[model samples]
Target chain A: MFEATQLNRRNETTQKLFRLALGGMTGILILPVILILGTLIWKGAPVISFEFLFTGPTKGMTAGGIFPALLGTILLVLVALLASVPLGVAAAIYLSEYAPNNWFTRAINLAIINLAGVPSIVHALFGVGAFVIFFKFGTSILAASLTLAIMTLPVVIVATRESLQAVPEAFREACWNMGATRWQTIRRVVLPNAVTGILTGVILEVSRTAGETAPIMFTGAAFFLPLLPQSVFDQTMALSLHLFVVSTQVPNMPEQLPYGVALVLISLVLLMNSLSIALRMYLRGKKKW
Target chain B: MTAMAPIPGRSTERSLAIRTSKLNLWYGTFQALFDVDLDIRQGIITSMIGPSGCGKSTFLRSVNRINERLGYVRTTGTIDVMGQNIMDPEVELVQVRKQIGMVFQRPNPLPISIRDNVLFGHRIHNAGKRDARSEEDGIVENALQTVLLWDKVKDKLDKKATALSLEEQQKLCIARLLPVKPGVLLMDEPCSALDPKGTEAVEELIWELRGEYTILIVTHNMAQARRASEECIFMLMGKVVEHDDTGQMFVTPKHKETADYIEGRYG
Candidate 1:
């Protein structure tokens, strides 16, 4: 009865065939990433140097470095982090811990989902209308970073809420039964355990914010400005915009210049992602049931 | 200053730990507890025994008001702890909980150091009045000693409480409640998650805790109820069928349902 029949053999072969096809699809997904990284390193490594990283672009478009653009990207990501992390984490705590089971809370959750689904280009337009024009911030770092913050808020909120919920309900009950108020339980127990996950979400947001070109294009990112921004109110040349300018907008640009900028930008994102992964692993090892 | 304050100078043994009258509870439209009028005496181990969904656990949760945490739950009744109606709108939940502690079916130690778990209640209840580390240490040692866990854990008080064995974790759960000096402790099948050995160890600890605190525990294990508790309550279908001395109830139950339940005819 346990011996494989002709039908069983056929089923086994079909399963193997399906596994091969799925494996091939996954290989296809990974192929481009390897190719992209390989090409960038091969074509762009020579252009990366202390001088290339530290000096401004010269010779009618691209010959010097992407120092200002690199600095601008860092500033934008930092400012966005400052603006979004607190707001997103607080909103998540309210939604996950305090919000009653009612239609108003459901409506707010629905609105958050819809906001996350709105496209980057739409966010750019909204940012321009709200911060740049209506709020009179003008085309500045403040406007662009605010736009990025708004774009990534849902990521932080969702990750934070998920992590907060992941903390066993028993822990909250233990606290509550010990005469703890909800705020006391959340402050003492919930937030401490959820912080690592929240940081991972914020880091993921940082990587995305660094690579986004559209939302910051009309609001803050400049095409070819070589001067470093002194304040949030100053127009800055971000790496994403610089890569675009060197690749398409500028005349007589060097062949390796755009590749070099793209390489650095991707590396920064990869670095943030690796940091998040390392942090998550380290903290998870320390965390117990 | 609060109206929920206890009446002074009542004899401890005769005074009620918990008294309920016409307690009706519903989860949305489904009623889970119906007219549960019970007098759980103070400073004694009273075990409630029943089948699943028989409202033994519900009655225990209702005493501490923990059932209201489920947003759908609605209760129309009075649960008086220490001669004060805890269901009164004027009574603060924090104060109610401070006077009444609860332990769950599964052992739940906070993912914190053993010392911190022991001190968690004392810290919250005494917020803004920081105690010296030395005094806190004494409190921890005393509480752990009471639960018979100090010898095994005294050397590693700073280690995570979750790292302990199941028996130790349940003991720690009991120990954590001691620092706050709650007048009543409600446990819902606290040994149900343990192995036979662990169950015996926890039962001994529960037995050791009687007379110092009013102990009301729910159990599925009839043998445990018979051996560990002084008084026993039997409930079926959300209503009490019997409440008597453990010896009398086990040997000569007043109700047919209680006898059938104890004799293992049906849960």
Candidate 2:
């Protein structure tokens, strides 16, 4: 009995040690995220002002503001969402609801996974090949938006499919037993329950599309377009590309200009993410079962 | 074959609501039901009783084509509902479903308001037609009233159907089907998820719905079958062993197998 008690004490100590190690590892994992956000806010907050946000850049991309870039980022994300949301959601619906469990469906699932894994630079080259040159859209917002849409389609499809699957099969069976067609069931039952998850995907796509510089650079983004884009066909200055240009390409640029642009871009993405999270919380509270 | 004509009072062939001739079903390579032939009457409660894995639920599902949702499920048979062959290629599924409503082992109310749940079937069947608000209210009230649930839930019509007690949810499920005016109701162990009180309440409600709709219920509880059903079917190994009037079958089971099963000798 004494030996058993001693063994139990040793096991307890070992378990406690393992728990502490796991906790420390978690802290280490989160440290970089905390440090990055802290440094960015500390360095970038003071540079952001209404004047800096609202006016156009001046003095050879050295001073004034990044309004054109901000507007271009917004436009790019909007058009990207417009192109991708419908296509992605439709594809996800087909994948989750209509597709039979066979090799063809498996191949489609594999393709989505591989598409998500492909490097951003490779996507940029493909975008240049397909959207910029092959389709003859030229270096314009439309081409960039299309490129970004394709790149983010996998994310939206996966997220939407997961949410669609999360809805209980019982619900679908119940609706079907009531003589509802597949489309009717999806429209009235499935889609409403899955909307919050789909919106979360769109929000993630917004953040990703807003931050990408490589694909948009060759497709439509200009190094320093002083004028805002008036149409889909016009080239525009993007925040990601502008930040790149201001920090590296332009000589003797203002010390805080790139920080301000970074701050705005980060803020935009964070704001979108926060809004989607709040919406998801509200929807969850309203969920009946 | 002596067990085939166990029910003495009612003629088996007359006024049939549903008839399955040489019914066979398979999930991929494995067969779940084999050569099932049953003549369910037009307006009575018939209960199917069997041990687990005996394909009673599968048989219930096949009546309304609900089993076809699974990709590998295949059925070769003629299920005629109200003298129309549901297996025919030209028969639209929505029409078949419109004529028949099903309740699952677990009560599945849509995650919507109680009022909307009642209107769902009517709205689906009558897609292009619009009803006045008062008309819809009447439909909801009448259906809920029929299920004996309106008095309990009348004040909270807009509340989520899922928020109700399990017994209420099950009753609401039965009530929702009434607005569609279906001729037959298929129930697959509808009381399996409820407590004793819930089961009793739902059983009483099912008994109340006896004459209006032909209810074919599958139950494991022998007592429920004896109390609520006019006729009872005993199945084992995916084959119907005996079917007869509930009183006669319980008092004088024709087959030795039926006697053993009812006497709790073996599953």
Return the clash pairs for model 2, or none: none
Q: Global lDDT for candidate 2?
A: 0.90
TM-score, every prediction:
0.96, 0.94
lDDT on C-alpha atoms for all candidate structures: 0.90, 0.90
Docking quality level of the chain pair in candidate 2: medium
Q: How much is A157 displaced in model 2, in angstroms?
A: 0.4
Where does candidate 2 chain B have its weakest 10-residue lDDT segment?
A: B1-10
Highest-scoring model, lDDT = 1
Off by more than 4 A, model 2: A1-12, B1-14
Residue B32 in candidate 1 has what lDDT?
84
Chain A TM-score compared with the true chain A, each model in order: 0.95, 0.94
lDDT of 1 by residue, B1-267 (tens): 353554333246477878999999898998888898999888889999999999999889989888888889999988888888988878889988888889888899999999999999999988736699999999999999999999999999999999999989999999999898888889999999999999999999988888878899999999999999999999998888889999999999999899899999998
- DockQ (0 to 1) for model 2: 0.76
